[model samples]
Target chain A: MLLDLLNKLVSARYPLRPPGAVKEDAFLQKCIRCRRCEEACPYDSIKMAHGDWGLKMGTPFIYPTAVPCYLCSDWPCINACPTGALEAVGEKENVKMGEAAIDETTCFAYNGIICRACYERCPIYTVAITLKEELYPVVHKEHCVGCGICEQVCPTDPKSIVVFSAHR
Target chain B: MTRFELHFYKHLNRYRRLIQILSVLFIFIVPLLNKAGMHAIIGTFYSVSIGQLDIVDPALVLQNLLLTKEIHFPLLLAGIIPLVITLFFGKVFCSWICPFNLLAEFADKLRKKIRPKTIRAKNQNAKPQYYWLVFGSIISVAAVSGIPVITLTSMPGLISGQVADLIFYGAVGMELSIVLLILLLEVFFWPRFWCKYACPVGAVLALLRGKNTLAIQYDAHICANNCPVNLKKVSLCNAACPLQLNPRQKGIYPYCYNCGACIEACFNKGGKSIWFTFHPQETKTNKSGS
Candidate 1:
């Protein structure tokens, strides 16, 4: 059946999230199944899969060969995910691949101490985290990898720098 | 002339319930809740080249956004009410209003057919680890685009008769196994889990939901003696939230969508303290849950 071919094509390229992740099947069912993921994909790899198998419901999948995973921060695709189907998670790289949170209180903005520890230390070297005229450190989530590095280096006790992981 | 009714206002819960009722109306009462307000505009502009419709979504808006330079007025309102509701009510919409939410719960109905006993929600606040792949990819793309591209990917199209379209056009001899699998997952795993965590709109709303908006209130005295944390997290209502809100929080958790199922569930438990605030007289004394 064509469904068989479709499944094989997808499986060969990308693997599904590990088992035990049907966080909300009911929620996924109602999704209108638009291809928002395609637009958000920095790599232009995501495609609206053939609905023949009905596997391509509301969630969008990546077809690596066409584009491959271009790991942009914030994963606008995750942010665009209307259902939990495209769940969010923080990577270990501590490289922010998404928006970073700034605790205004402890943020260097209020810390009275000048430091762009995150901006300077970022591994991607794009200055994803920026200092707002010596104000609080604003995170360009697009560059953040959810690696908790900013959070780790935050001098504030409350930890002004933090990433909202699994937030996509 | 009349004195302000603010004195009598439960303040928070009033707007909370109003948000809930409004979301319900948006979802259920609307002609096509999923595709409401999307067709006429996007149809003329996008003209999806699908079946007979020949509608192309991106083309319609992209052309408009680029050429006309005038904002597609409707696009401004796209997911506005729902998004605003999430900011105010902590995603109560997921539980009460969204038809998909209702269907998600109904899918669980299949569960009842299988087992008379209900499987309770446990560990409601477990940090989602799987999101790494999901959020990771999305963030990667956003970084490159410098725009919220997910807007185009997620958030189902709200075209009219979309359900029928899925049946006739979408379901045409499609894999029954995938459909059944999604159904099985909905019935067994987190019922409305997708709406709870993965919804990009919901996430955006939550980011801005830290305020005095209307939200579920778990009064310490009442919740300690009568909270429903047993079913899941800190409270019964919290556990039921498709968005996984912490009912015990003093103010809105930003993710709360104001869905009233939690209110209904709490009412079922015979808790009088749980009140839906809507100014004054409108406060419905729960005949039954929280």
Candidate 2:
């Protein structure tokens, strides 16, 4: 439909939404773009989408490489959302911002560099990421909340481990 | 002007400027307070919370209702406060509280200063219906596309949001450029263009005015009988209006935000022809030429 095409055209990038964000379509519909979530984040992890984001301008997103969500236990961002674009989940661990994937070709650990940066930095270490044969770090996608702490801490120059947006 | 009237009218604009400046400062102060571990008051103009009370933009709430196809009671409740204010006060938010309006006023002054010979064009003042048309188009586009498009264009929301962003993140986003671009156009080309003809936020607020709402009332008899100024030329009230509206006419009420600039101008010009009154019936003047 024409509406779908317009939505697609305006949504320039599927940037990682903040914790407790609803589905992208619903989020767009409900979000009034108040920037309350941005103000609530203690780590300043939430950022307002700017002009480059097309119609998504004023909506909140997180560029985890620069400042990853610390994933506060209280979910202040969700509490700050007045429009219900961000709903309160039962547990912080249940937050599914996106899923993380590691590129074997660029990964230092895969290239025998023995990097444990991502595994060590993972908030849900044992569940989200595991040691493969006691050397490689393997991501369990279902368990990974995609907070992007691993991407922030990745030793690789281009970030071997990246969190892809849940919607994408 | 009498000594007492002079004293009073001089302070009217001074009070307005104080409120305008305070609102601008409020945006930055809230973020700084939030950073200092305070959570009592928060958010930008799009929506804000002062303790347990959530005050949201009525236009955004309307957009949300259209796009989501549901009634959100909390947001609806939050939106009512502004609607009630606009219902009684007649878009005072634009003149007294909107930071963008303060910036636009400065831009209008600068435009006059840079080009002193600039003449007021007849077409400069857009018809009120055009503002409604723009508002309707925005709402329709938002409903169809399932996007809150007004949030992208709302100037007050953008200004407050960017201010918070600057305070928290230590840098403003590219969205500030949109404001800058509008201001550039305001300075160089059209004066009071966005608020008069384009802003959906103002359009919605202005439409909420009732017959009893605070509005600028003009006494034609005072101007026709008592005024020494030439009626053929631009009167002081018309000259004082930032939106270039003829305050003497009732038709211009929709475009008027009860800024009282013209009222102050009339007082300064030694004529109490124009003033704000909630009860328009008591101050009803003769149906003469505007």
Candidate 3:
């Protein structure tokens, strides 16, 4: 119980950048902390990254739970960035901030309780998340853009299904 | 209007306060104003833009330069603009526009009212940490992965961005809790703790202004001649200083933001001895008396 609590507390749940974030090193160098990306995000998903991340402080990021990106068709964040820190990647599928992975031990469907929360809410639907026996969810790494809708919609407390930030 | 009727410093103080309030308002409105069709005004304290023009924080830019080992153009411009402003203005940003100072002023007022008279006396033990923080950040950034860690302690930039975040994005982070904790500290323990001593940004502004001549000038001859008895008493200018600085002292230039409160106090006390000027004055007078 204590370990579970600690895991929830200290988990590496770093916020994912908007649709068109460059690699971490380039992003840090390129971003002027203009906050244009945050402002352009229609869903209010983007927020300025504060001190906790050290040097990336005042840069833009999106916490999925607070407000997940609605994945607008035009991608306003990329367009708003004047510094090219966030490039205009062509498609929603092309912009991979991170990938959603399931912890089967805590997932209700895996525990025979029958839940398809992640599979139902995933942006890519059948491709990103698919149902096993038409019930338990299985995440396909290639199809998942890590928009974080699945994690946001996850019914399980401590989120059985969570999106881990993409390793640049 | 006649020179006597004009109330020069009073109007200046009012203007400074107006700018400070406007800056705070600008941060609050940034997200609202920045939209798809109306991409007119955007950014927070770290950076800001009006149309195509942009202003970036020099300290953050310098940190990025140290870390990345490559010079970026826009960020360099952002960093240089503030440094240039600090060059002519001499830490006027702290007095006229820092959003954190507005919050601190309110907190300081509450502190003054709530705390007893005995404890309200400015503690003499408080040492200025701005220099150490500035240098320490540089050393640490070089040693620890080249990323500037100074922003972690930068109250103005951090809080302004966070408050904007909380209002526009409906998001709050650990920094809010940290700010609240500091606010609590400001109210009870030490007044003007962060601004007077700790802020790295303020340290950078002070260093940039290094003996640059623009400062609160103390006319000792005038004070010595008129109201010499009042000069022996606790100075109104010293009491008016939010940073607990003696405006009459020559050494106060480096730390004096030219906030004009001291001048206001002097005016209130029926003396116009203290005033802002760009002329270099004698440093010897600072050692003479309180």
Candidate 2 differs from the real structure by a C-alpha RMSD in angstroms, to one decimal, of 3.0
Candidate 3 ranges beyond 4 A from true positions: A1-11, A22-34, A47-59, A63-96, A99-164, B1-6, B34-37, B116-148, B169-171, B210-213, B286-288
Give lDDT: candidate 2, residue B249: 60
- Model 3 C-alpha lDDT versus the unseen true structure: 0.70
Q: Is candidate 1 or candidate 3 better by DockQ?
A: 3
lDDT of 2 by residue, A1-168 (tens): 454566578764688999999988788779989988888788888888877677777889999899998899988888888888998886768999999999999999899898899999899968899999989999999899989999999978899999998987
User: Model 1 RMSD to the real structure?
Assistant: 22.7
Per-residue lDDT of B1-290 in model 2, one digit per residue for the tens?
47765676756788799999899889989999988978778899999988878999998888888888888788889998999999999999999999999999998899999977664533234566777788788888877766677888899999998888788778888989999999999888887889887888988898798889997878887778887677566567777788887776656667888888888877776777777778875444344444
lDDT of 3 by residue, B114-184 (tens): 98562333313233354566466654654354334555556676777676677664787777676778888
Considering the two chains of model 3, state its CAPRI-style docking category.
acceptable
What DockQ would candidate 1 receive versus the native complex?
A: 0.03
Question: In model 2 chain A, which range of ten residues has the least summed lDDT?
Answer: A1-10
- Which model scores highest in lDDT? 2
What fraction of the genuine interface contacts, i.e. the true contacts, does candidate 3 reproduce? Answer: 0.35
Displacement of the residue A15 alpha carbon in candidate 1, Å: 28
